[model samples]
Target: MQTTQFMITPASGKRLIAKALINYAPVQSALESGTLVIIAGTTNGYLAEEILSSIGQLEDFSREKFFRGIVLPPSQPRTENGRLFDESGFPGDVVIVDGKWKKGLTIFDVADDLVEGDIIFKGANALDVHKKKAAIYIGHPQGGTILASLRAVIGRRVRLIIPVGLEKRVSTDLDEIAMKLNSPGAHGPRLMPVVGEVFTEIEAIFCLTGAKAEMVAAGGVAGAEGSVWLAVSGVKQEVAVAQKLIKSLSREPLFSLPENE
Candidate 1:
């Protein structure tokens, strides 16, 4: 097995992540013409939003677009603070609200509207919905469940785009990583095994490690103490290429350490 390693302090993780994303051909292609990119994750939404906002390609569709032809959820009334909350069956580009968790939408809702040039950045559920139509699904290895479900639905169409920070990498094998991360008491829920099962079914896998988020308050990296991100895909050729890229990126540094002082 091959692996890639990146070593960065928390302060530089986010910037490295953004740079790594630019390396993906799918993302670069999608950015050519602003497309609707859906970002999903447990708590990484804020980071994803910030990244997209800095990219200068995000589109905030209003009710008019939803009513016209853009297939999105209805816009809810803005709050006193000008914030919009998610209501039942409400879909929009930007998810800026509070207390707005609903049953969630499926890929079928937006599959018909997805074009070959569109991009998607989502978690497991959203990936399951748009895997067939998505050029690439960007996130961690936990997204395997979505890939497995997508394979059942579309028989392998989407590719994987993984962006990771150096602090998240580990020397353990995939199974061990899954076990440690998904164990009942691990990270608040059982996610590792589920993600592990999905890894076996995907075609391509890309892993990037070298982004650290500086924790201004904690005086260190937010989750950089010991964390990593894994991403898998259902596209074989793409996965093979990604594996090679990961290896190339993981090569040992050529610098030498100084003598003991």
Candidate 2:
């Protein structure tokens, strides 16, 4: 029951989650013999890099332009879909099959081909950590990638993994929030409550190092904005491993948005 505390910035947390997911059982299984789709988002960008690097196919891949939509500062202009006005440089989603990176492909390109035992990794905009629920914001008239991924996930038993950060956590029930946001009178992006395995920094720490982690507190200034204070506890060896792993990511460079994004 040895416990250790660590401060994890959002950037470092993304790296930690990415490191953990590379060793995830379902991810490993899908990489070797099944379809694994990594939907483009800020968090998934990190996971994509880790997964791609593990298979020696990291070339030509950059997180800079990996996202389809993004949340920018108040001053930054964005479309109704939360995407930058300019999207000419956007790359397609990361779709890996049989351990090879299928360059220039997206879920739509292979959603019909996916079946049971396949896995999809998508990012989330809101998370109900206590209830283990996650949801995404949709500005598309015909739903979005979640709809595409759901055809296989709910209809064909494909596994869906939601990789999100603790910073995105919300205290309200997602369904309730969805009700308000999706209302006819509501303005801006609608919320879609999704069902999947919610993987956060807590889960990431456990997955990678066998240590239990809890978000004890949050917030900071300077480079610590959106940072979380994690209290990790477990066996002596596991806590040691968690400490080392967190240390390795403590200096993960601050993620920067590409020009005009």
Candidate 3:
């Protein structure tokens, strides 16, 4: 795989949007036999949904894959106040709360218990548990929490796949990302200082160049115009997959770095 660094301005990058980015081939390739996938983002769960839609696993894909299964947080159940409990029935051992996994837990803790040989969509902690065992996908957030969590769990050799809309760019570095996560105005009611603490710990970073909305459309679903998406995995494959998806959407080039010379 080719690993190179390129700079993209928020204005130019946002133009592409999540609706225009997403390379399914790389993502599809990653899902061979037993690959755990963890998705992270700030939205309620729209980001995760958009990603699944893109990969042909979504029902609207017309041809669904029986081999794929999704395990979401208990809080996001199908019933009323679903976001307050775990409806997915994730084995208690896999779920992590504060630094502890459930009874049957192993690598991941209670909050980090999302795993699958196929793909698993989850929040930041869950992504941490499966970082090495799976791919990671991230979307728009205040900053730091997901990155920091990656650092705590993923360590130095870990890679990050960040698929973000141009709308979510900051001109600052990881430190800046932390500031936003801590700033009262940055994130809404879900105020938690730990979010900022985790973000600052991220040492490895890679940006996935694509739009979430477009990836959702590729899943053959309609009415996905303004939805969010998430995917958590190593940086190399995720960015590569995103580049491929960007190419499929239009004849125009995916991205062009400004002349530095």
Better of 1 and 2 by TM-score: 2
Candidate 2, poorest ten consecutive residues by summed lDDT = 76-85
Estimate candidate 3's alpha-carbon lDDT, on a 0 to 1 scale. Answer: 0.30
Reference-based TM-score, model 3: 0.31
Task: List residue ranges in candidate 2 displaced over 4 A.
Answer: 77-81, 259-261
Clashes of 1: 16
lDDT of 1 by residue, 105-189 (tens): 4333443344544444443211121122221222334543244334422433333333333333234454454466555665422
Query: Taking the tens digit of each residue's C-alpha lDDT, what string does model 2 give over 123-146?
Result: 999999999999999977899899
Q: Residue-pair clashes per candidate, as listed?
A: 16, 0, 41
Q: What is the C-alpha lDDT of each candidate?
A: 0.34, 0.92, 0.30
lDDT of 3 at 144: 25
lDDT of 1: 0.34
Q: How close is candidate 2 to the true structure, as a TM-score?
A: 0.97
Candidate 2, residue 245: CA error in Å?
Answer: 0.7
Point out where model 3 deviates above 4 Å: 1-26, 36-56, 60-153, 156-158, 173-261
Scored by lDDT, the top model is 2
Error of 3 at 42 (Å): 7.4
Q: Which whole-number lDDT from 0 to 100 does residue 208 have in model 2?
A: 82
Candidate rank order under lDDT: 2, 1, 3
